[model samples]
Target chain A: MGARERIWTAALIVIGDEILSGRTQDRNIAQIASWLNVQGIRLREVRVVADDSDAIGEAVNALRARNDYLFTTGGIGPTHDDITVDAIAMALGVGVEVHPAARAMLAGYYETRGGLTEARLRMARVPAGADLIENRMSGAPGIRLGNIFIMAGVPHITAGMLEALTGTLEGGAPLLSAQIGCWVAESEIADLLSEAERSHDGCQIGSYPFFREGRVGANFVVRSTSQAGLDACMADLKAALEKAGWPTIAGGI
Target chain B: MGARERIWTAALIVIGDEILSGRTQDRNIAQIASWLNVQGIRLREVRVVADDSDAIGEAVNALRARNDYLFTTGGIGPTHDDITVDAIAMALGVGVEVHPAARAMLAGYYETRGGLTEARLRMARVPAGADLIENRMSGAPGIRLGNIFIMAGVPHITAGMLEALTGTLEGGAPLLSAQIGCWVAESEIADLLSEAERSHDGCQIGSYPFFREGRVGANFVVRSTSQAGLDACMADLKAALEKAGWPTIAGGI
Candidate 1:
C-alpha cells in the first residue's frame, strides 16, 4: 500500500429515540470507540437517528456512501418498529426474505421458550443476499450484506458482536497518547502555546478547560503514536507555562 | 415577540482528555439538557474537545457566537488542566485576575481541608468582569459573564449550581413535550406516515430504532407542548399504522 492508502473505518447508526429524549443511557458509542481504538479501526461518525423507516433508510444510504463499513442497531425486533431489515432492504434496493439460517436460529430460541407465534417469526426476516453474523449471547443472528451489519441495539449484544468482528478488520495503528491534567486557564499559555505547537512537528498537543470544584481551568494533553514525539512536545509546553508564572499545581490523571 | 426575538441556548465544552481518550463517561450533556429544557431554554449543540486551551478557546468562541448562553464544565479544579477561566478570559479579550469572591470561596474550602497554598489559590483566578456561580458541593465558585455560565464538570456539583441559579432566574414557558416508545419498524408504514405528518399542526414526532431481547425494532416518540395538538397527532399516526397492518404490540415495556 502507498502512503496515501486509506485505512478501514465504520460509522455507527444508533437507532433509538431514548438517547434523544434523555430516557435511556447510551453505552454503545463509548464501547465501540474503545474496541475500535484497540483494533486500530476507526469508528468515524456516529448518528443517533429516530426509528422512522424513512430516517433509517436515509441514514443507512448516506453512511454506506461515505464509509468502508456500516453498522446499524435497533429496529430489528418482532414488533412494529422492528423495521430495520425492511428499511435496509429498501435502502439497498433489495427484497426482504427470511434467511434460512436466521429463521432457524430464531426458531431454536423461540421453540425452547415454549411459544413461537407469527409475531415471533417476524424476527427472522432478513434482506436478500445477506450473510448471518452469529450472535453468541442469543440465538437470532445479525445480518451482514455489502459491508453493512445490522445488529441488535441492546448494548450487551452490540458489544458482543463488535468484539467478535474486530479481529478481522485492518485499520490504522492505534493512537497512543500520554497527558497530564491540571487546574490552569488556557490564555495563560496562549502565546508560547502556538510556538510549542510549531515546535512539535509530528505530535499534536491539546488544551482543554472544565468547570469543576467551583472554578474554571484547563487540561493540556500532548498526544502522538510515537512516545519520543510526545515527550519532546510536553517538555516545551511545560517550560513555556513555567516561565509564564502559571505553573500547574497538580500532575498526571 | 418578533421573528428576530432569538431564544437563548447553550453548548457545553467537556475539556478533559479522559473523555477523548475514553477514560471517563461524560455526565454533563444530558444533565444540562434536561435542566435547560425545564427552564424553557434550549441546549442546541455540544462538542467534546480535548484538554487543550487553544481548542477550548476555539470551540467556546464558536458556540458563544451562535448561542445567547454557554456553559462549560471540568478544568476548574486546583490542578494544572483547569484552564477554562483562562480560555474564556482570552476569548473575551479580557485578562485573568483573582476575583475576590472566587478567592474567598477557595480560601473557605481550603481552610476546611487544610492549607491554602498557592496551588489552591490558583482556583481563585477567574476572568475579569465575571460574576461568581457558587458551588455548594465544594467551595470553589464558578463564574458568569454576559450569557456564559461556567460551572463544574463533576455531575453532582454541576447539577447543584445549575439548580441554584435557575431557581433565581425567571424563565419563559417554552413548549413542553411527552414521548411514546414502542416496538415497530419504519419501512412497514412509510406512505401513510407522511399523510399523518401533514395532519399535525404544532407537534413533531420522532422515531428511533433499537434491538432488544434478541429482536430489532423502532421506538416511536411523538412530542408536543399542546395537549390537544399531541392528542390529534397521535390519533392519526396510530390509525395510519394500524391500517398499514403494523399495530403496536401489547405487553411491551
Candidate 2:
C-alpha cells in the first residue's frame, strides 16, 4: 500500500469479570472503536478476557505485537481484582512500581476528599518506565507503556482518556462510510452488491438485513479510506438497486 | 478438578466489519454469555474479528482449541461478505458443501416468497459434515460441526438457536451470585473485601463502583458454584461493611 493508503490498526482487550459473567454489558468496545476512527486508526480486533493475570498477559502480548497500538479497558481500579498493571508488566518482562507523577496527581485529587489511602494509592502503580495518560474523570490516570495503553474499565473514564490522547497518536486517512437502505431482502440484491464492490477499488459493501413491519429489509454500508472511492461505490450501488426496481433510502432505515 | 466440580467453558468469535468499523454495536457477546451461564457453561473468552477470511479462520482455530465449546456469530448470510462457512471449513481442514437439509429448508421457505436464486442458495453451504441448527425466524439455519457452532449475528436469531440447543449440551453446576450495594467508596473497604474473598473458599467477589446522585457507591457481586458458599461470603462481607459504619443494601442499589 502507498503512504496515503496505509492502514493503521489497533486492538482492544476488555478486562473485566462483569462483562464475561454477563453482569455488565460492555460499552468500551464501541466507544473505543469510534474514538479510534476519528483518529484515523482502525480497530482491527477485540478480545474480552477475565480479570485473571495469565489471560490478561497472553492477550496483551499477542495483540500488541501485531497491531500498531494496543488498548485495554478495565482492571485498573483500586480493588484487589485490578491486576492489569502487574500482569502487563510481567508480559513485558518489567517490574511494577508506583510512578511518582501519578502518586502526586492522586495525592492532589484526594487531598480534600480523603488522604490517599493504601488502596487508593494502588492506582498509581504502573509498569516500569510507563507514562501516565491523563484521566480527567478520576484521580487515577491511565497508563501508557510503549505502544500499549491501560485504560479505565468504566466507559466514561475511558472516554476522558481518549479525549486526552486525541490528536497525539500518528494515524493514516480516516475510513469513510455511507449507508443505503432498501425495503428488499438482501438476498435479492446480493449479486448487484457484490458486483458493485468488485468494480470499486478500495471499497467494501456490507449488507445488514433486518425484519421490521412484518417485512424484510436491508441496509447496505459502503466503507473506504478514500472519499471519492466511497462516493463512487455508493453511487454505483444505489444505481444498481434502482435498476433492480428497488428504491434506496439514504442514511439507512 | 473432580468430575462434580468440573467447569465447561465456551469461547465466542464475533465476525463483522461493521462492528470493527464502529458502525454497529455488538449485542451477541452479552446475549450469548448470559445464555451460556444458564446452561451451566462459562463464557471464558470472546474475540471480535473482521469479515476477512484469514482473520476469521485464525480466531476460529485458536479459540476452538482451548475451549470446550466454540461459538461464532455473524458472516453467515447470503451476501458475499458471509464467508464464515468457508473460513471455518479451511480452519478445520474440511471442504465446503451444500448440506441437503439446509438446501431443502431454504428451497421450501423461499418457494412462497421467491424462487431460491444462487444468492439465497449460498446460505445452504456449510462445512462438510456439519449439522443444521434450526432457525425459526429465517430460512437460513445455523451450522454445528463437532464442538463449534456457527450462529447468526442478529441477536434474536441467535437467541432462537440458543433456545433450540438448550439442555442438549453437557454442563457442570450452574454458577450462583448475590449482590450487596453500599454508598461508600470501594477503596475505603478494599482491604476488607479482599480479606472476605480470601476467607471464603470457591467464592469470588467483584466490586463495581459508580457515581450517582453526586455520591460514590459500589455494588459487590459474589459468585460461587455452591449456594451456601455464596451466602456465607455475602453475609460476611455485609457484616464487615456494617461494622465499618457503612450500611449495605441487598440485591444491589
Candidate 3:
C-alpha cells in the first residue's frame, strides 16, 4: 500500500471469563483503541471471549488473519485459568515452554519475598519462539509472537506494556478529532452534519445525543487522518449549526 | 442437545466509530452480558466494529448464524451516522421502511416538543417484518428481527430495552457464582485452586489477582449452572485456602 493510501489496522481479543460473566467491566478495549490511534494504527475490531482455549485460539487465528496486528488481554497470570499463552501456542501449532529470560526475571522478582514456586514459574511460560514485551509494573513480561502482542488483563500493567511499545510499531498517519456540542436535538441538524461530511473528503462525523438538565442535546465528533480535512469538516459543521439557529460549544456538553 | 445440558449462547455487535475511535467507552458489553446471564443465556462472544454498513452486516450475519441470538448496540439514533437499522436490513435481505406504529409513536412524542421533521422521523425506520421493542424512557423503540435485537448505544436506554425483554426469550438454568478472596499471591495457591476445580464436577473457578495496600491478593470466582454445585465448590475452595494458611474473605476484596 502507498504511504498516503495505507491505513494500518489492529484487532483485539479480550480473553477473560470475568468480562464475559459480567463480573468485571472491561477497561482495556478503550485504552487499547486510543493507544493504537495515537500510534497511527486504527483499532478495527475487538472480540471478547471466555477463558476457553478453543474460543481464544479461534479469535486469535481469525483476527490475526484480517488485521495488520492482533492483541490479546487477560489470561496471562499465574493461575490455571491464565491460559492465553497456552491457547495462542495451540493456535500457532507449537508447544509452550518456559522462556529462560522470563524464568530468570520471575526468579529474581520473587527471590526477595519467596522462592519461585511451580505456580509462580507458570508466568514464565510462553509460546515457542516468542519474544518478551517488558512489563515495568510487574515482573512477569508480556509476550510478542509475530504480529500478536499478549498483554496483561490488569489495566495498569497493560498500560505499562503499551508505554514500553511506543514508537516501535509501523503505523500510518495519526487520526485527528474535533468535537462540537449543541443544545438542539440532533434530529434538527442531522442534514447539516451529513452535508458537511459529504463536502469534506476523508472525514467522518459521529453524533452522540444526551438528555441532561431537563433538555436534550448532542455532541458531534469529526475525525480525519488529515489535519486539514478534519479542520475543514469541523469549521463547516460549526458554521452550518450556527446558521440553523443552534448555538455550538467547542468542547462537548 | 440435551434439555439440561444445552447452553444457549448469544453474540453482540457494537457498531460505531466513536467506540472504535476511543471517544466513547462502552458500557453495553458488560450490561448485556450480565443481562444475558440472568436470563440463563451465555454471551459467547462480542465484536466491536465501525459504523460502516459492510462491517455491521457481515458481523450480524456471521454471529447470528453461529449463536442462538444476536444483539447490536449503537448507530440507531436519528442522525445520519445511525445506520445500524439500514445495515441490518440489508443483512437480512430486506428493504428498509418506516413502521407505521413507530412513526405514530414518534409523531406523538414530537408533537408536543416540536413536529417530527424528516430527520426525527428517521428513527421510525426498520427492516421489513421487524417488530418494535418497547422503549418506555424514549419514544423511539428498539428493533427486533428474527434473533437479532438492535438496541440504543446509550447505556440507560439500552438498560430500559433489556428490562422490557426480561424473561421473554427462552433460556436454560441461570448460572450461579460465589466468590472467595484471600490476601495471598495467587501463584502460591494456584495448584490448590486448579485441583479444586478439577475435583468439582461442574464448577469452573476463575482467579483474579490484585495488589493493594502493598500486598498481593486474589479473588476466586466459582460458577456452575447448579446452585448446589456452586456452593459446594466455593466451600471446598475456601476450606482448601484456609488449610493452606491463607485466610479467605467470604466476598471479594
Candidate 4:
C-alpha cells in the first residue's frame, strides 16, 4: 500500500426533543453524511440528543473535541425550545451574541411578510466569534464557530445550507464505491467477501442482506478512497460471486 | 402536582458502516423510539457509530453506564463485519460463548435451507451471561445482558424483536401527548407555547415549523407523563392560538 493520505473526519449532533419523542423522523443524519462524503470528509459518528441544554452542551463539547469538524442540526428555530445556540455557546465557554449580518438578512426576508419580532430575531444569535452560514430557504441562517456548523432542523433548509457550504471546507479524496447485488444469502459467500476485502488494501466491503421477492439476496458495497482500489475490489467480488453460481447485478438491485 | 415518579430512560447505540456512510437511511431510531415510549420508557439519547469494534465497545460502555436500559442495533449478522457481540462482551468484561438455545434455534431454522454453516453459527454467540430475545421473524435471536438489549440492524427484524420483548421491561407511566397545528408562523406563538409549558408543571411543548402549500405553519406537540397534564397543556396552547386569531387543527395538519 502507498503512503496513507490524511483522512478528514466529522461528527454530527442532531438536537431535538421531537426526534427523541419519535414525533419527527430525523432526515439530517443521512443528508449530512452524504454531503460530507461528497466533500471528502468521512462522517465518523452521530448523536441524537434532546433539546435540553445540558444534553446539547455535552454532545457539542465531546464530539467537537474529537473530530476535525462537527455539524449540528435542529433547535435553531424561532421558538423558546430552540436552545442549540445557547447550549453550544455555553459548551464553548463563549457568550451568545446576535450577528449583525444574520440580523440584516432576517430583517430583509421578513420585511414584506412581517417585521422581525423578538422571536424571529432569536434566530440571529450565535456563539461569540462565530460566523453566519447563509440559508436561502428562510429568514433564519445557520451558524458556524471554529469547527462546529449549526444547521436547521428542517431538511430542506438544511439542504440549502449544505449547498452553500459545498467545497468550502478542507477535505481528503472523496471515497468511491461500487455495488454488486446477488440473489444469495450473505452467509453463503461470507468467506469470499472477507477474502476479497483482505486482499484489497485500503478497501472495505459492506454486505447488506435483504429478503426480497420471496428470495434471499445481498448487496455488497465496495468502498475506497482510491478509485482504482474500489474498481479492483468490485471486479474481484463480482467475479467471485459469479464463479460461485450467484449471478451478480452491477450497481446493486 | 403529585409526587414525581421515577423516570426510566434508555440510550441506543446504532452500529453499522452502512448508516455512517449514508448508504442506508436509519429507520430503527423512530421505530425503537416509538416502541420505547409505548412501553413507558424514554429514549434519552442515541449514538450512531461505525462497524469498528473499538467504536462499538466505547459507545456501549459509556451509554450503558448512565442509562437504566441501553439498546444496540446492527452488527449481529453472520459476516466478517458482524462483531457487535465481541465488542459488547469486551465492554462488559465478559467472554463470548455460543448459547445452546440460540444454536439449536439456528440449526432448526437452517435445517432445510442449507443447514447452519460455520458462518451462520456466528449468530449464536453472545456475552457470557446473556439471554435470548426471540426473533419471531428470523432465526438469529436478539441478546439481553443485564440492561443491554442487542438486536438486529434490519428494521423489520428489529421490529419483530421489539414486539417479542414488549411489556417485558420495567418503566414509568407511559408519556401522553397531543398535537395542535396552526397555520401561523411558530415565532408568533413562541411565547404562548413557552408559557403554556411553564403553567403546566409536568408538561413539555415542542414546536416544529414547516412550509407547506405556500404558507408557513407549525405543529405544537405537548407531552407529559400524566394524561391530565398533557390535556390541560394542549387545551391552553390551542386556546391561546385561537385567541391570537390563528385557528388550530386538533391532530396537526
Candidate 5:
C-alpha cells in the first residue's frame, strides 16, 4: 500500500420518518454505495434516522467527523416533514438562508409550470457559506456545505445530482471484485475461504449463503484494490472448492 | 402519560459486507422497523456495519448503550464471514460456547437431510450466558443476550425470529396513524399542516409528496398514541385542505 492508494471512506445518513416508520423502503443507501464504489470510495457506515431535527443533526455531526465525506438523502423536499436543511444547518452552527442562485433556478423552473409559492420557495434554503450541487432533474439544487453533500430523497433526482458530481471528489483505486458460486454449503468450506483470504495479501472474501430449489449454496465474492490480486484470489478459491469436490460456477446461480 | 405508557425504543444494526459492497439490498431494516412498531416499540435508529468483527462489536456496544433494546441481523451463519456471534460475545465481555439446546436442535434438523457436519455444528455457538429464540423456519436459533437480539440475515428466518419474540417484551401503546391525500402540492399547504399539527396535542404529522398522473400531490400522515387525537388531527387537516379547495382522499394515491 502506497500513499497514493490510501483508502477513502464515506458515510451516509438517510433522513426521513417514512423510512423509519416502514412506510417507505429506502433505495438510496445501495445506490449511493454503488456510486461511491465507482468513485473509488468505500461507503463505510450508514445511519437511518427519523425526520426529527436533533436526530438528524446528531447523525450529521457524528458521521461527518469520522468519514472523508458525508452524504444525506431525503427530507429535502417541499413538504412540512422536509427539515434536513434546518437540521444540517444547526449541526454546522450556521444560519439557514435562501441561496440567491438556488432561488433563481427554482423561479425559472416553476415560471412555466406554476408560480413558486411560499412553500415551494423553501427549497432554496441552505446553510450560510454553502455551495449548490446542480440538480437537473428538479430545479431545487442540492446543498454542499464543507464535507457534507445533501441530495434529494427521490432516486432519479439523486442520480442526476450524482451525475453532476462525477469525478469531482478525490479518491483512491477503485475496488475490484470477482464472484464464484458453488452448490456446497458455505460452512463446509469456511476454513478454505479464510485460508485463501489470509494467504492473499490485500484481498478479502465474503461468503453469502442462499437456499434455493431445495439446495443450499453460497456465492463467494473476492475483493481487492488491485485487479491482479483479485484475479489470483478468485482463481485460488475456485481451485480449492473444486479440489474439495464442489464444482464452481463463474457467475452466481 | 402514565408510567406504564412509557415509550420503548430499539436500535438495529445490520451486519454484512455484502450490503456494504452493494452486492445485497437490505430488506431487514424495514421489516424490523415495521415489526417493532407492531410490538409497540419505536425503532429509533439503524446502523449498517460490515462483516468485520471489530465493526460489529463497536456498533453493538454503541447502540445497546443508548437504546432500551438492540437487534442485529446477519453474520450469524456457519461460514467464516459470519462472525456476528463472536463480535457480540466480545461486546458483552462473554466467551463463546456451544449451547446444548442449539446443538440438539441442529442435530435433529440435519439428521433427516444430511448428518450434521462439523460446519453445521458451528451454528450451536452463542454467547456464554444467552438463551435461544426458536426459529421455526431454520434450525439455527436466534440468540438473545441481555438487551440484544441476534437474528439470521435471511428475511424469512428473521421474520420467524421476530414472530417468536412478539408480545414478549413490555412496551407502550402502539402508535396509530391516519392518512389523507390531496392532489395539491404539499408546499401549498405546508402552513396548514403545521398549524393543524401545532394545534393538536400529542400528535405529529408527516407529509410525503409524490408526482403521479402528471400532477403533484402529497399524503399527510397523522400519528399519535391516542386514536382520538389522531382522528381529530386527521379531520382538521382534511377540513383545512378542503377549505383551500383541495379534496381529500381517504388513503394515499
Candidate 6:
C-alpha cells in the first residue's frame, strides 16, 4: 500500500490439527511461498494453527489485519475437526450457511456417492457476505471474506485455489539482486556499505558471510528498485573497497 | 514437562526485516519442521516478526511462555538493522553488554585487517543471564537466555547451532510413521475418518490428499504409542473401509 507499489501480499495460516500434533511436515508454506514469490506478490508470514476454533479465528483476524491478503490452508474439510469455515465466519462477524454456488459445487462431487446427507452438506457452508473461491480439483470450494481467502488443507485443493486467485493479485515491482563474494567480513567494507545503502535509498543491502578456498569472506548483495541505482551502488561500493586496501579483482595489486 | 517419555521440544521464531517486508521466501520453517519431526520433538508454533524492538520482544515473551525450548534464527549480525539482541534482552528484562564468551569467540577473527571495531563488537553483546551457543564457522556465537537459543539467520550457522544443541536435547521416544494411499477425496472420507479418529485415541491420524498413479487419493497415516497398537488400528481401518464398500486395499497392497 506504499507508493506505486500495491504491495500485494498474502500470509499463510495453516489450520490443520495434523501439523501441531507433529503428524505432518507441512509442504504448503514453502511451495506457496516459492510460487507467489515468483509472481511478485510476497507471501509474508505463515502461522500453523490447530483445529481449535479460538486459535483459528485469532490467527485469521491477526494476519488479515497485517497483510494485503491472507490465505488460510487447511481445516476446511468435511470431517468434524475441520472447523475453519466456522472460525473464518466468526472472525469476520458473519453468519455462515450453505450458499447456492457452494452447495452446487458440493452436490456435483457428492451426487455419485449415495450418502449426500446434512453432514456432507456442511462443507457447503460459507460466510453470509463472501465470494466463492473456485475449486478445480475437488468440489468443496473455498470462500473469500475481505482479505482472507480460506482454502482446503489438502495439497491439491490448496494448489488449485492458488491458481484460481492468481489473476486477482497485484504486487510491487520485483527487486533485482546481484551477489559478489570477497575475502572480507561485513566490517571490512563498512563505509562502502553505508554509501551503498545511503546512495540507493530504494535498495536493500545484505552481507552474507562465507568461507571458501581456505578463506573467510562475505558476499555483499545489493538489491534495488532500479537497475541504474544498483549499478551506482555497486560502483561506489567497489571504489570504497579498493580505497580501503582490499584489492579489487580487476585493479591489479 | 510432559509424560515419562523423554520430551523433544523446539520453538522457532523467524527474525528478519526482509520477512516483514515480504522480500524473501522463508525456507527455515519447513526445513526445521522436517528436521524436528524426524527427531520426535515437536517444532511448535512459529512467530515471524520484523526487526522492530517491540514486535520481537512481544513475540519472544509469548513464545517463551508456551514452549519448553526456543530457537531463533536471524538478527544475530553486525549491522544497524540487526536489533535482535537488544530486543531479546528487552523481552527477558535483561541488559546486554560485551559478553566475555562472545568476545573470546571473536578474538583473532580479524587482526591486521582494519575491520572488527567497536561497532562490530556489537555482535559480541549478549543478554546478561545467557550462555554462548557455538558458531563453528563464523565467530558470532548465538546467545542462550534460559530455554531460548538464539541463532544466526544464515542457514549454515542455524544448522550448526541446531546440531550442537541436539546432544543436549531431551527427546520423546522417536516417532515412527507408516503411510498408505487410498483413492478418495478428503471430502469423500469424512464420516469414516471420524470413526477412524475416534477408534485411535492413542495415535495421531493424518490424511493427506494427493494425486497418485493418476488417481486422486488420500494417504492415510496412523501413528500410535506402540507398533502393536499401530498394527491393530491399521487392521481395523482396512476392515472398516471394506465393510463400508470403499476402495479397500490389503495391508501390503
DockQ of each: 0.10, 0.84, 0.84, 0.85, 0.73, 0.34
Return the lDDT, model 1, position B245: 62
Q: What is the iRMS for every candidate structure?
A: 6.7, 0.7, 0.8, 0.6, 1.2, 4.0
Which regions of candidate 4 are displaced past 4 Å?
A: A1-4, B1-4
Give the top-scoring candidate (TM-score): 2
Model 6 docking tier (incorrect/acceptable/medium/high):
acceptable
Q: Model 6, which residues run further than 4 Å from truth?
A: A1-10, A17-44, A109-122, A153-159, A167-187, A210-231, A238-253, B1-10, B17-25, B34-41, B79-81, B108-120, B167-177, B223-231, B242-253
Q: How should the candidates be ordered by DockQ, best one leading? A: 4, 3, 2, 5, 6, 1
Q: Against the true structure, candidate 5 has what lDDT?
A: 0.89
Residue B32 error, candidate 3, Å = 0.9
- Over the true interface, candidate 1 deviates by an RMSD, in Å, of 6.7
lDDT of 4 by residue, B181-222 (tens): 999899887888888889999898899999999999998898
| B39-128: candidate 5 lDDT, tens digit per residue | 888899999998888888888888999999999999888877788998899888999999999999999988886778877888999999
> In model 5, which runs have C-alpha deviations exceeding 4 angstroms?
none
Which runs of model 3 end up more than 4 angstroms from their true locations? none
TM-scores for the candidates: 0.62, 0.99, 0.98, 0.98, 0.96, 0.81
**A177-229 per-residue lDDT for model 3 (tens digits):** 98989998888888888999899989999999988998899999999998988
What local lDDT does model 2 show for residue B178? Answer: 90
TM-score of 3: 0.98
Candidate 6 has an lDDT of 0.72
Clash count in backbone of candidate 3: 0
For candidate 2, what is the lDDT? 0.94
Model 6 over residues B1-253: C-alpha lDDT tens digits? 4674655666688887555444455567666665676666777677777666887887888778777777788888876567889999988888988888788667656455454686578889988978888878777888888888888887777888777776576667655556665666655666776787688766666666666677666767776656776777777777776676666644322
